[model samples]
Target: MRNGFAKTDDLIKMFNVSPGTITNMIKQLKTEGLVIHQPYKDVKLTEKGREIAIQAVRRRRIVE
Candidate 1:
């Protein structure tokens, strides 16, 4: 989330992943300083996260 927060439930619904899977992925991202997660709250992306996301999107577009 760059401009807004994203809840795990919302991410699960969107990605069709299990809660535990999402939780672990979030934890990893947090460890990388890409995201910040709080208990029972939405996740927020850091500036580094946004930059990485944007780069990923660009790479995807190029591959496509």
Candidate 2:
């Protein structure tokens, strides 16, 4: 889920979430400038999003 883009279909399969749920989440991420999403295309993270994701991973590792 990092270092590259992911299609909505792939995300759906991975998360087992509804399409509407993924759409809404993508919309929210777009609003936050954290992702670039278009209908029928892959989703990519912005630099800000990537940094945040890395920090989250580090935090999770610390917690574990």
Candidate 3:
């Protein structure tokens, strides 16, 4: 969801991944209804996606 909803170019650059990879992931997430994309707009996470991201953030913090 974040990939589609946020500025993903930076992350792509950081990860050195191709745009196709990012697009595929985003498409998969959307297909799962974890994300919603508005035409010509940043991707937005569904409620489910937000919940998942929040939990992920917490896990990362704890790990750190």
Of the candidates shown, which would achieve the greatest lDDT relative to the real structure?
2
lDDT per residue for candidate 2 within 1-64, as digits (tens), equals 5559998988999989999999999999999999988888899999999899899999999999
Identify the runs in model 3 with alpha carbons over 4 angstroms from their true place: 1-11, 38-40
Residue range 2-49, candidate 1, lDDT tens digits: 356998899999899999999999999999999989978899889999
| lDDT for 60 (candidate 3) | 100
The true-versus-predicted C-alpha distance at residue 40 of model 3, in Å, is: 4.7
RMSD of each: 1.6, 1.7, 3.6
lDDT of 2 at 34: 95
CA error at residue 44 for candidate 3, angstroms: 0.8
Tell how far residue 62 is off in model 1, in angstroms. Answer: 0.8
Per-candidate TM-scores read 0.91, 0.90, 0.71
lDDT of 2 at 11: 93
Q: What are the per-model numbers of colliding residue pairs?
A: 0, 0, 1
lDDT ranking from best to worst? 2, 1, 3
Error of model 3, residue 29, in angstroms: 0.5
Q: What lDDT is reached at residue 1 by model 2?
A: 54
